[model samples]
Target: MTAPSAQTDRFVLDRMPPRDQWPAFRYDLPELRFPDQVNIASRLLDEAVENKGWADRPLLRSPQLTLTYAETRERVDRIAGYLINELKLEPGNRVLLRGGNSIGMALSWLAIVKAGLVAVATMPLLRAAELVQVIDKGQPAAAICDARLLSELELAREKRPGMVRHVVHFGSPDDPQDLGALAARQPPLFRACPTAADDIALLAFTSGTTGMPKAVVHTHRDVLAACECWPRHVLKAAPDDVVTGSPPLAFTFGLGGLLVFPMWAGASVYYPDAPYNPETMVRQMREHGVTTCYTAPTFYRQMAPHAKAIGIPTLRHCVSAGEALPDATRQLWKEATGIEMLDGIGATEMFHIFISSAGAEVKRGAIGKVVPGYQAKVVDDEGREVPRGTIGKLAVIGPTGCRYMEDQRQAKYVHEGWNHPGDAFLQDEEDYFHYQARDDDMIITAGYNVGGPEVEDCLLAHPAVAECGVVGKPDEERGMIIKAVVVLKAGQTGDPAMVKALQDHVKSHIAPYKYPREIEFVTVLPRTETGKLQRFRLRQHTP
Candidate 1:
């Protein structure tokens, strides 16, 4: 890789992993190779129009509007021009983006990359304190946010004055100073910045389930390489497929599934007018003729009933990730729609999904195989490779891997050449990887090891259970006792009879000892903004 130009700002570059510590990146795959200097937005968006020869094809669609490839390209260029000429943002400056999933957010992300600035995208649900940490850590030069979501960001800015130099708001028609008004004053054409492929493109903050969020640095080549690996091999999306999902664009999952994958396949994506519940998601699929969808396992479980009632005939592909996909949820979705859910595991550090399976390759209970450009293994606690069928830590190396910015945890996350993702798994003789539990999520009761997710899966298979979380509770007799926290479906009572029935159900489904020794019912389970269950919260309530 070539060095960044002298004029390029080096805030993000200076914080990256040292050259010797970086994972071994493979560009031998034809699709993985790129020029020394590449602008991903230009290659994926602008060149897409020139190569496809039909600029009128729809690229982005929402209930409010549908933009053609030509239209999206023009708006992206105008936004790039606005950032460069009006805001005076220099190449390599970090610009924070805060919004729900919307075309404006998508345009800002593409424009940021096109203009050679590092994009720092945040979840809309983050409060002032969380935003302050991101602001202080990234030290972004400017922020472009949705007007509806500006209050928290403003509060954060007050606490850290001068950290972010400029603030621009969009999505409020009444505000004349919004990004839309500013971009309208700029020309619709802007030249793409000549950035080195190694230059950092974005700083993705972890979900902070354990503690303070760590910023994961990814580059232009990293982003494009992610696009090449999974979508090309597993998804195999066509040019006419219409995609929609519930994951926020700020998430790497949503970034790849909703934006990058579709653009690379020359397909279109539909952003819902509002955040979707299961009912709304089903309705949208029926009304918009959605072909592909992306969401989590819990969401698939919730939507199974609604999808059965509302019949999504146009839907073909469904993706489940962000957490382990329980066997019961996968079976329920298949029974309802006859379409198997493609399961994958990815991290912000890797940019997108690296292990996934789709269509006929979908296995019964495994999370598919390693993606084409990646290699994975199960390693013991001491970093030695373990034999098949032995549960151990999952270590991976590929075109993209963990590169935490200026964090000591970087040393812990990567060792030798493998990225340890902190999850335990077992590989079968057929080379299929099965997720067991997070290294921290395992439970030991009466000297027998149990995976909490295995119990949670059994609970989800029960008729009256809507959601559940399992953890180990302190006990004087047994080293630890398996405890379950559950949420009942609507119109179901959380009485002792229901708890007894759930316990009986689990005992019958799996080993009797793995059944929850105690059960508690709640109205809702604590989860992160991206819909990942916070098992730590459940552990706090355990006695």
Candidate 2:
């Protein structure tokens, strides 16, 4: 699964030498499979226990609780034994985990993996409809949910019975089994089940960006494969550094950044309950001497305005994903904190970062060069490679690539040994890729392939438009009309004249055809917790 050389276009890996590995750039990469075969939990935890001798080193930090590595591993083993012996959780049994940010939540996640059960961590904010939808799709045999959120799962059970027969309460003991008591009954040590490379370890569902949601089956290798790329080419995370963040552990971005990445290097992560607020997060960063931080671009934008107030700067590196990191946000952060935030684009399918700048390759606005092992090129609808600097659908190929849970989307993603997620981006002459909007989000009007994000950037430039969503609407003459759904600043009114002014403003800033044919103002647009604008939702209801 090696990428082709930079000069030649042919693909080669273990069987053949990379055609462009000119001047002795070849390094042998060991092909180690993921959890099923290698048992990452045993490899990381047991190895740390033996060599490092986990002696009360702090692993989790919150306003209320502080857990050490030895304590964490003990709890993880207890829960693993309890899950396997008591619950009879054999390999491949799907288990849904729904809970708020807590240390218990983190331990439970690892325990499931240790027990060889497939873990599906859903965002805590999801309600009955979303819960029932995933449960119906995944048919999880059991669910571990906080008592506070138990009512939602109950409602979901009403809609889809027999989906989850067993429920483990996180907040209290309601099922004759508490996480602590259940673990205490089992042995202190647990060994991983003999598994294979392709064993499904996680079934991460999408945010339903395009349409109905579907499960994404990630192998044990995919989980460890992500950690493989982190230090190899992407963020060079050291073992002694501490990782902290604001994303829920449920999100793949958060799981990799805060939990897995740190564990891969035998480092610790700080998890606080009330630290989601920017003010509290900064306080945690200073108090904990947090070294690595991964969060969304919008969170950075919110923090940049008030960065000066939060002092005590010991942070080393920061990463941004989930949404486009606006240059305005990046520059403001650097000016305020003296730390440059690296931006990258990753989806639910790929698990970890694929396109990011690392080391000294910061380009401010441009997403960094394709990873050394990954091959990314701009291609047309037919999957033919396009010339550099031309905006087209961005396709990727690498050792650690995508494998969709189903067939239809998998066929669409895998083309000519490449994976295309329908994102439109342009590659610079220097091999860096700049993200355009999604191909489905492109607003075509009057025979123009106007990218929605390009128009949204223009609208974002306007001071009045606090947030905006651009989409193409049905039209009588021009095939499709450009429509902009806008959220103005507080106390601002959306009048007909204001709409006209916004249209005129867009026309002035960019091409005339990019002007919004329709503008509707609202207080707020739909957004995922990661701050990614839900354009499909906006299009469904508004347009």
Candidate 3:
């Protein structure tokens, strides 16, 4: 149950899936309970300054500016005033956000939610073709975009002329129509909207690493509840910690790891001025005095070789998600920096990490026990619990779960009080959850089930292999054959002897029958902007 809504525009609220189809939520932790009327942006910023006494603590730090808690609240309030008083936007009007992980982008996102508007954030690399899909689905009333990335968004807006009525650009100091300039004109004190805890706060679209994208709906309570679970139990973040990461704010992994979790712990996030590469990321961590880091396994793999050379003395915690953390990558990073990587598995539907272990609790090959506030089990195809050590779909229920907006896939994601995250997993006697491959990505060769990650992990350990992706290619005789598309190291050549050496390398390490039957060498592997390997693209393009 929830308090009365304060939103005037019910476009998103009206389209929410029926209540009966929703996953059951739990509030075992004291912090998970919240008042019926609450706004996340206000609860995170204003309460921190006014009640928690973080007024003078540094909050948002970037190359351009560093703002204390009180100063950030003032900027957020002015932006809220511009959204409400100048733009004439009513509560619950969706505001589309398009930008990189910059100070301007963070302020815009906080202001949108503070004013009781639904924030729809898109990836910075998406072109007009992909942007149109989000615009048609979210049907936003206004947009706040980075001035540098405005061209593609403008092209998308031309296709759907009436979808978004207002637009403002940020990150442009000289433009009078920029968001910061307009925000400066408004009073620095604006009342926060009284949104219900259950009111929709953001619409997060899937990264489409697999296929079609789905819009995930999350509430104010969902955001705060997530902050209570993972960070409190596993992360144990301190107020003085400095956080830095490569995941973009558009991805939910970044949104929580980089922004929401840091704010919850009263930590500061330092955004680098330049886009991160392996060299740049390591150098930035050393220069910025970062204590906590977050990125995917792919980035960690690439950065492992450079970590010790550049030196990051202040770094203590390294969190990996967005994709599976292969044992090879974890070992590589540990050998380089001597810091045990914290591996967790989370989905956009679940909002953030539900299963993770930090410090000495981390297991060798399993994502640790469920966070204090969540429950997870591996279940067979028919929705019954499977025995330990048996691979099945991963079902989870927590403070947050899947709530898709007007998508038929909602039923497939949520059923019988549990949200199935579409991944295959197995539980051990110790209750550690071991990740298999995505249910659809599992390869069947000669009637034997082979997880692609197991083979890819073996290949990653080889000296000549820089990167690789494994998929099942259709075959007339054997049903499907395991195909490996590999990217060799700079000095390595893909000759006949080299292929035989790699094939022999896999046979010696893993099962001989599970080796890749077909191998193709290329300069680079196809990957999503978030550093996830695009297996679907490999299935399409691999010959």
lDDT of each: 0.89, 0.74, 0.91
Best by TM-score: 3
**TM-score-superior candidate, 1 or 3:** 3
Which candidate wins on lDDT? 3
Q: How far is candidate 2 from the true structure (C-alpha RMSD, Å)?
A: 6.8
| Model 1 TM-score relative to the real fold | 0.98
Candidate 3 lDDT (Cα, 0 to 1): 0.91
Instruction: List the candidate numbers ranked by lDDT, top first.
Output: 3, 1, 2
- Give the C-alpha miss distance for residue 515 in model 1, angstroms: 1.1
Residue 336's lDDT in candidate 1: 90
Q: Model 1: per-residue lDDT, tens digit, 1-543?
A: 675552278898888878667766766689888888888898889888888764888999989899988899999998899999988989889999999999999999999999999999999999999999999889999999999999999999999988999999889766789898888888988889988888878999998667678999999989999989999998988888999998889999999999988998899999998756899989998899999999998888889989999999999999999988999999999999999999999988888887888888878879989999999999988889999999889999888888989888888888887888888889999888888888888898998888898999989988888899998999999989999999998999988898789889989999999999899999999988888988888888875
234-344: candidate 2 lDDT, tens digit per residue: 787776778888777888888888777777777888876752678778877888888888887767766665666876477888788887776656766788888878888
**Candidate 3 residue lDDT tens string, 303-329:** 988897888999999999988888999
Q: In model 3, which range of ten residues has the least summed lDDT?
A: 272-281
Per-prediction TM-score to the true structure, in the order listed: 0.98, 0.88, 0.98
- The C-alpha local distance difference test score for the whole of candidate 2 amounts to 0.74
TM-score of candidate 3 to 2 decimals:
0.98
User: What is the alpha-carbon lDDT for the whole of candidate 1?
Assistant: 0.89
